[model samples]
Target: MTDDTMGRFGLSRRTLLRGGLGGAAALALGAPAVRAAPREVKISMQRSSVLFTVLKVKGTLAERLAPLGFTPTWHLFTSVIEPMNAGAVDIHADVADAVPIFTQSAKAPLTFYARERGAPSAEAIIVPADSPIRTVADLRGRTVGVSRGSGSHYVLAAALKRSGLTLADIKPAYLQAPEGAVAFDQGALDAWSIWDPFLAFAEAKRPVRVIADGNGLTSYHRYYVVNDGFVAAHPEVVATVYRALVEAGAWMKANPEEAVALLAPIWGDLPPAVVAAANSRRSYAVEPVERSQLGEQQAIADVFYEAKLIPRRIDATDVKIFQPPTGRG
Candidate 1:
């Protein structure tokens, strides 16, 4: 068993093999470990959201994430799907429930990581103060402004079904929020299907009426989405961002006035009162995405597919849903 005894025997083949094996094992165990690549959490921002602005300006999110080794960066965006598809953003703060369905149908590499509780009244179908459109049924044969596959789209669809009307019953003027708001103001549109703070902005400056809102019509569960590439590579970073958002959401809900004050200057100089009114309709809560949420997402997908708005049918649950870090360390 002694090295000197083995050497005295002039090195048997078995002993040589044992010594070689020990040396190799020692080399393998002594090797340094390779570190994972550093990742940045690049998030897309929107002035329309209350939490995102507050989170960005207050820097509370950075403080929370610094402990976890990440600091999210924000980018401006107009649509939920475009910037992500073009590689301009890594995550979107609050995408509508119906958007990922269209992205999936288009074969975009995207997934949902976090979701919001239903805030139905946050979006609605509005008309000018003096317009003859008194109910959802009154939209018949008239042009209404809408952005296809948005939460507003679902609000319009469900409101129509309740009124015994369908998308075919009215002419759709496909437009985003600002452009749509402009059309509504200039009398080029009979009605506009929009969400807040655009909803609040329109009401604050113009004489308009909400004929029908999402209160009883749409799912209204907005989501946080990530690029498939980003989630695959930086799950922990994504999870960190999600947790920061959860924290920021709680802070905003508990301190509405502070959120409004933090957001007013960032949100196109929106008055604090108007910002407060818009934030009131929102749930300002974040929860993990699960099967219960997927059902309405499937309904949204089927509706869009049936209308030929999306090229193909999609299973909403097929995409990635973030499960909180269950000690995945």
Candidate 2:
């Protein structure tokens, strides 16, 4: 047939050969193969995610997902769980471990797909350098800034308990990152419980002392969560996204300079050195979530419940776990 006639068939010679081989193989197996329709996956992003930020900037995730008939639609959120729980996003990037605990307490249906190993030192409670507060106990009766359900909140609680105090012992100014930074800079809050790169930014620009970090208190794992319904309906898409995250994390760790270069401008033009310092505190090793490793999550949930931060107690490990493809870490 002529080129125009062949073009009307909408099949190239190579494509025909591949299709025939596939058809013969399927017939040999006595089953028809199937392919899913193209799908759109809404992924959540935040400035805190150095890994996803780099991946998003590079646009490599889209290229990686294209082969699987999935398109990525990224939505930026200051906090991920609320929007993800509201059905605003399908895939949630890594968020502090404590975030999911609160979501679970609220009965949000989310599945844990992957986790970044604990980088305990990534968050801390900071006081002015010359402040009289020299220890965790000093925080009692002091006005402290903290994001209510953030990882730093749990760290603050654990730190205080170690020093014979509780959330009630202090006057907590429940503030988001921006508000917390402003309050801290203006000396309205005695101390701020926060995580990087905010932690890194504040330290670089201000005179502060870190009274405590998550080191001995919590692992501070960052988790990737997916809406439960989406998890069941589009497992393949979830797996692809998981693998892409794993690869992106690995790439960032391997190329520190490039990673910082990509992150600096995005982090409000923060100095590269500051960004590097913040990144160094995080463990970019993404792995599948296991029930046994959830001890810290359970502790966070119990602590929050006891502190009356969450309305109800939750079994942290009761949520669904999405297994990555076999042979993945």
Candidate 3:
């Protein structure tokens, strides 16, 4: 038959040899499958801070991945967003708000693989116990200090909105957490917007009151995200790492006292009481991203967009890399 006739009849020279109909049979008969080896991953973590919960997975992850032939390297980043944006780190452990901000501003192709479940109420706006800032409404016309672009900034914005105030209503002083804490203590700033364990530390010394926390104001769910490319290329490794973190989180919850002792040596000789207080508020479950969680994150993004904190609008759900929840011991 002519070439045109063969094409019309759904029979071609190439198709005949490949045996489209019998391909599975041929493969099942003698073809050998090729499997690729696992890739090494370099996980980036915050050097020191309450963000150091990443350390909980250090050795456990290595042991977990032994069978998969995956090796994990731990590195420290001073700021989670910068390293994540620059592609200097494959994974980031920080507040969920960071994901939306970076995704909107830096256009980083990052995706959330998992989040700490049970919504730990860790971040908040703190006023000295003697300070008159009892409610969010009281902050109007006063100076409020927050780390620009961090989760604290988002919390501050939400707190203001809840109290019928806007950023313009208050004088915002941009400073790092440490500097802000010092300034707050020294009476340079009226209030400090911060996250734990710094928040816990500040409360321990002198007296500080949590004017508002992440409970109703923010999702504040800590997340473990990797670059989209990295996640797509090494899903198995990502799954393995997440599994280890979930286990570590559970361990911390079960043994808060022991967890504090384990973290003390690395966290600059913090008082046991301070560490215990911080640990009490932290949840360590690696809950998979759910629609409600994404909705809350989207709300954060929308608020930031309306406030012009980010130049453009973004869809929070577009950046998530969802994986089925895996049980861990």
Candidate 4:
């Protein structure tokens, strides 16, 4: 039967009462009101960069929401910080550094949704394998390339402090990931502080060594944040997206090679070997944001404040709004 006829006449007796029409007489006598179909949810995500693994392997935000009868419109952003600030994207997926900037600028209605579980390694400090820079201390008096104000900048600062050094100890070359990667190859940069898969790519191409990862050294909590209004209006959609990401993370751990294969094509012709290596180091589980995580993030903020990276002192914990895990039935 046609949908209209079914709506008008075929609703079960129980359905009529539950729908608040109270009686079958009402259903038969009154005209059936056609309810609007749910609109598709559009989620914005950054293209392949640090959060690439989570987006590609954990299922693109759009792919996950498709099963829930939500058509996810995937909008690509070059960098998470810019898209978030410009209100170009619905969700920003990357490290939590942007949270403070967002809060300070008040450029967007954004809130921290979740963190990647188990202290995920989102960024690192690396030198070419053949380089003489052996440790964080070795970076002193040398040019260190990093994206200014990015997570790499935060990692660089924290790593330097660990070795009794500061940003002043090294020559800071502010370059984006692609430019920094190229500069490092040309020996223009003595060291490169960057996030994956650039870090993974550098390691694969040459004899690069990791001076520091997101362990005790860096408060690199990868975050999934959304436009505040969008989140409030469609919490269920956000929850569903998070559930898919958690499952995808589990799948990546189980099938690393398969995950790599799934992501390779979307990387815009990155070498397969590099993609494979990068995939090995990614963590995909979604965890609820905790106080400890916020505290670590706050440390980064303090460092930035001391270094004069940003104009104001930011309270990092204020923007962290955690949501419970979306349980799958």
Per-residue lDDT of model 3, residues 1-329, tens digit only: 56798699997656644776445544554555445665567777662323335444346676777677776777765456677777777766555564456554778777777777544367888898899889989999999999877777888998899888999999999887778878988889888888877787788777888888887877677776788888887777777776766667777788778888877767668889888887777666666776565777778888888888888888776665658446542
Write the residue-wise lDDT of candidate 4 on 221-327 in tens digits.
Answer: 57777778878877777777667667666777787777667777776567778777676656666676665567766777788887777777877776747485557
In model 4, how large is the Cα lDDT of residue 82?
67
Model 4 regions lying over 4 Å from their true place: 1-40, 47-69, 96-107, 118-122, 268-273, 320-322
What overall lDDT goes with each candidate model?
Answer: 0.79, 0.86, 0.73, 0.69
TM-score of each: 0.83, 0.87, 0.80, 0.78
Report clashes for each candidate as comma-separated counts.
0, 0, 0, 2
Instruction: Kindly indicate the candidate among 1 and 2 with the higher TM-score.
Output: 2
Residue 29 in candidate 4, Cα distance off native in Å: 17
Please provide, for model 1 over 105-142, each residue's C-alpha lDDT reduced to its tens digit, 9 standing for 90 to 100: 77777778888888888888999999998988999999
Taking the tens digit of each residue's C-alpha lDDT, what string does model 2 give over 1-329?
Answer: 45576589895545544686667555554556676876788888876877777768899878777887888888887767688668678888679999998888777778999999889999999999999999999988999999878999999998998899998899999998878988999899999999998999899888899999999999999999999999899888788778878888899889999998888888889888999999999989989999889988998999888888888878887888988885532
Segments of candidate 2 deviating more than 4 angstroms: 1-38, 327-329
Q: Give the root-mean-square deviation of each candidate in angstroms.
A: 7.6, 6.4, 10.5, 6.4
Off by over 4 Å in 1: 1-39, 66-70, 326-329
User: Model 3: clashing residue pairs?
Assistant: none
Question: lDDT for model 4, on a 0 to 1 scale?
Answer: 0.69
Candidate 1 residue 89 Cα shift, in angstroms, is 2.1
